[model samples]
Target: MRIDLTNIPSEGKSLHFTLTPDWWKSDLDEDRLMGLEAPLSASIKLYPAGKKIAVEGSLSTRLVMRCDRCLEPYGWDLSTDFRIYLSIAPFKGELDVELSEDDLSLDFIDGEFLDPAQIIREQIILSVPMKTLCRKDCKGLCPVCGCNLNMTRCSCSSTYETSLYQNS
Candidate 1:
């Protein structure tokens, strides 16, 4: 999970990692991510940028998620690619100093190591869909009976049917 900065050569390095659900359980739960299905895998490339280290990588995994509409569990495939710049130099002077756009992409390394697992965990959480649905045409659940509209017709449908026939 942690890589030694001293090992990174000026010519750059390529690294791959595999992780399990246990490694991300804490962060996933904090983000309310439910039902992880398989192992997480990633491939990363590190480049030396003067005093800064540049990291670029991609992560992929399968997850079991609940449908927001039907309340049913379903499987989803997730993949994401990201790039970040890391520096060992701490910003000096005032703690409340203002930062420019260039500072936004810069991440300060606390020591001489980088935690790739932590970065992958954050990226996974950010990739989660805002609105999760099992399908595009999901009818959702019946409000009164709490029945799945996609599975069976609820008693409420009969009431509407009777009213329509009575008016004829």
Candidate 2:
């Protein structure tokens, strides 16, 4: 959803919306590893701070993620809060400029509108864990037979030797 900058009153604006799984499927990339199990509830408040706009929001939802260890899909609950400051892009011409420490923290908007969907999408992606696991004690798959060890025991022996260099 796009919010017009000019429409925001001096008193500020507050918005509440629900983002659906279908919206995520369409907005996210095709290789997205996770899916939304339920609709996400988001609330955002926008305030004009000097020449910049400040946005504060919170979201909660259930996500369907794949386990890295067992390669199984599992549900996870997610709740997060975020804050960002947006300003109009200062550089219009094609010129290389060095960025400072303060420049790295703020978000730049292109036109006179701000897209909250983009912010939510970025937050959701950043919230995901690097290593996903269905359970801590997952046995994973057997190397020899490619069988899921968590489901059933395999006949493959676990005593496999390893060497840095093999004589060929």
Tens digits of per-residue lDDT for model 2 on 3-73?
88656777889999998887775324323356889999999998877766678899999988878756788
Enumerate residue pairs that collide in model 1. none
TM-score of 1: 0.72
Per-residue lDDT over 36-155 for candidate 1, one digit per residue giving the tens place of the 0 to 100 score = 688889998888877667788999998777788778877789988988766555654111212323323223233566677766766676677887878886667776687887798887
Number of backbone collisions per candidate:
0, 0
Best by TM-score: 2
Candidate 2 accuracy as TM-score = 0.77
Provide the overall lDDT of each model, using Cα atoms, as 2-decimal numbers: 0.68, 0.69
Q: List candidate 1 segments past 4 Å from native.
A: 26-32, 90-110, 157-168
